[model samples]
Target: MSHVSGDLVRRYANGDKGIPADQVWALEAHMETCASCRQLLASHADGIAPLLDTVWAGLTPAEVPAKRRRLSTWITPAGFPWIGMTILIAAIAMLLDALTVLDTSFVLLVAPVAPMLGVALAWNKNADPMYELVAGSPRAGLELVLRRTVGVLVVMIPALFLAGLPGRVSPALWLLPSLAFTVGALVLGLLIGVTRASVVLAGVWLLVVAGPSLAEQNVPAVLHPASLPYWALIIVGCVAVLGLRADSFSRLLR
Candidate 1:
């Protein structure tokens, strides 16, 4: 790397992202192959992490809320996967109708499609046209999580209500799966930076939860029953995961 490039990496490592981004991008490109430069970037991250924590902690509620909203600026990018999610949701909705699953119960899955896709599209930086904006801010992680989660919920709930009009599963009941999947996968995404672990965990969680249900095995009634405490625990666990690690958790939006 050139001398200028070395200096920029130092600034970035020191968490001085104020450097014109082009300068930093050059360093990141070079650092991709250069271990010494990567080491520097890691050092910068160490300093930046603590500083970000302080910025996050001292954030006023008002500031936090606005910052979260700012992350909503991007629409999910258009792509095959999103089209697939939409098609899957639509197919499920149509199947519910044909099967005459509770008029309303079947359709609930329909609403969340757009929002889910939208957020997914936004977080997907692969074809992202907004890297500059996303790259500029550390808070992008938190905002990214909040935007997609909130956006999908806004669409998913309404569509579900519309599609499942008959006395199908209670919206309250179905809402659990949607919310749980979002937070759970989102959490895993943040930690692993990939959907594989989250997807695996989800499959396992489903087996544990729905498998017992589908098998309809005889169980001690008390052990089998899903009590209020169970729901409370579920909620508490999800909330803790979201709240305690908003920074790290938000990174999962990727």
Candidate 2:
């Protein structure tokens, strides 16, 4: 039942003005644990009332039809299907390896680019229903893109690792290339759309690496241990480029 003094709460809510630092901190700390004091502070925030009204009025009708959801609400529904598909692909690849249906390790061949597929969907204007709304925010762009990419990766990397486990696939065989390819997609996405960039990278890999490697029954040179240092360099270079060009993603093409 204890509370910050009404006068202090009112002064704190109205404006810091001449309030002492210790008093301000005390008021804030009390407000954190006191709902009645919070209400008192809100009541004192007369100047903010009109602004709050304006913001409430601007809420879309679509937003009011249901109870506000959790942080999961922020993730677009479009991403779920794509994430599922990415998981299914990993599962199927593992199954194929288990059955020995393929002459080569199908899992390794796809692992590098598999996660990017979901990453592409994570921010694709075509896939995300709220892309315009989300993309238009000032906090959008590379920061948001990287966050979503990380989210996709969180689900993907483990799945890929699990798939590769039974086959004894070396993490180096797929992990480095995966980072390199993901960074490549991100860098390319700044120029083109992320989805298109993913398609281009996947297509090129299929045409130039996967298809040939399969036909010749040889592991691609890029995925070989001798080539790992090269892949490491590529990953480093690409990440540096991404950091330098991070600003470009802010004004990314729709």
The best candidate by lDDT is 2
C-alpha lDDT of candidate 1 relative to the true structure: 0.53
Pull out the clashing pairs in model 2: none
lDDT of 1 by residue, 1-254 (tens): 45335566667776685888787777667877888767766765765687788898788455334344242343344434554565567557656666753323334433322333434444444545665466456757656657655755665566556555543534554555455555655556555542443445546654665445335532212222264355456656876876777676333344
Write candidate 2's Cα lDDT for 165-220 as tens digits: 98887777898888888888887887788899999999999899999988988788
Deviation in Å, model 2, residue 185 alpha carbon: 0.4
Whole-model lDDT, candidate 2? 0.82
Runs in model 2 lying further than 4 Å from the true structure: 1-68, 73-77, 101-103
Q: What shift in Å separates residue 19 of candidate 1 from its native position after superposition?
A: 38
TM-score, one value per model: 0.49, 0.70
